[model samples]
Target: MAEGGITVTIDDAEVRAGLARVLAQLGNMAPVMEDIGRTLGNLTEDAFQASGPGWAALRPVTVARRGSAAPILQVSGGLAGSITHGGDATKAWVGASKVYAAAQQFGMPQGYAGRTRRGAPIPWGDIPPRPYLPIQDGGLLPAAQSEVLAILTRALESAVG
Candidate 1:
């Protein structure tokens, strides 16, 4: 289970309408939700593989500390591997269950007073937002939105046929 996560709701009128129609005809949205969850999970994995397409590059200090040019957010692959998705009939969600997932996804500002066990600055420097989920500004990214719309269209067509 995730303490912090992104829930992608279908805000597009056309996609929402198509989904509503399909759900009405199918009489159960669970299957559709499952499909959406799985698709989103895969997309999130792709984001990790791409090292977050639009994310800022790793800082030189971070690279040196890591001892190599390992991708940001992938030092141990825990955050990426912790990604999970699930939904009931009404909603779907995708996110990582890692404790620091929120900080990693949203970023921590510099000069914050938080400290680690050794009394060092929690982040040591600003960690720019590196959104690994296929979402932006509270909605799925354009590509992801298109993929979801395709899924909804297929479901609608199947129900209609």
Candidate 2:
């Protein structure tokens, strides 16, 4: 008892009950996160397909975090995946590493040296720009947004009601 005749004491039972409730709520979030991840993956894949062959080979991968169970959507494939979304040479990689993807997506210098199939040196002639990813506004994003919103709305309703 303190000055106001109020006493604060540790209640192990109450603490246990509160922890249980929190754990239960956390348990419910996994399925919702997984559903969201799948939906996003499908949407991204569709966008890639519509873009063109240059972007169609990429695939969407979803990974769930171990601590928070949050979902992360990523576009992945081999070397092609690096430059599909946008033209950049920063992430290009070969045996060691090189900046060639951007040259292909954008264009190489007039007389840049490149290799032939037989490893012979050849002039890197003019290469045309070919962008194939992140489909334009009238592409897959709008539909994906709607579907994702619907899924999240349902999840919220189920969780609350």
Candidate 3:
């Protein structure tokens, strides 16, 4: 792709275009989707409380942004711990707290940091960086912003520590 060395596959470009379209769609769904996230959490809480191990075994567990990534907590007794994904950071995600510590401490092998408001890096490393939101106002967000923003926000909010 970098000027004439490796031949770029058609599928590669198709995937990129498809992702852009998805991002635009996500921009439209941002607010409502955020609410849906809350509802799912609430439903899980109620169901788990009502019945023992209601969703624990199958838990829709996704450890990283990519679905292919192996779950940090697949079907363990939960000392293994679940992972999160985020989008537009409603709570502090791309903030000054290293999420990796928790993953390491809890015995998670690997995880994703997720994205910021417009797909910027959230905090990382043993020392977390200060949260810097490139687009403070939602109106300033670009069309491509949603995919990263949406998932990362959810992940960090779910992680919280």
Leading candidate by lDDT: 1
Ranking by TM-score: 1, 2, 3
Error of 1 at 69 (Å): 2.2
lDDT of 1 by residue, 1-161 (tens): 65444334446665567678777888778878888888889998998888888788878888888887767788898998899887688866687877667767778777654433354556658888988887766667788778878888888788888
- Name the runs in model 1 displaced over 4 angstroms: 2-14, 113-120
After superposition, the stretches of candidate 2 with alpha carbons farther than 4 Å from their true spots are 1-27, 52-140
Q: Is candidate 2 or candidate 3 better by TM-score?
A: 2
- Give a tens-digit lDDT track for model 2, residues 59-125: 1221222232121112333323432211111111111011443433334454555532344333333
For model 2 the TM-score comes to 0.33
Best by TM-score: 1
- On a 0 to 100 scale, what is the lDDT of residue 15 in model 2? 26
Candidate 2 least-lDDT 10 residues: 87-96
- Worst lDDT run of 10 residues, candidate 3, spans 1-10
Alpha-carbon RMSD of each model: 2.7, 21.3, 18.0
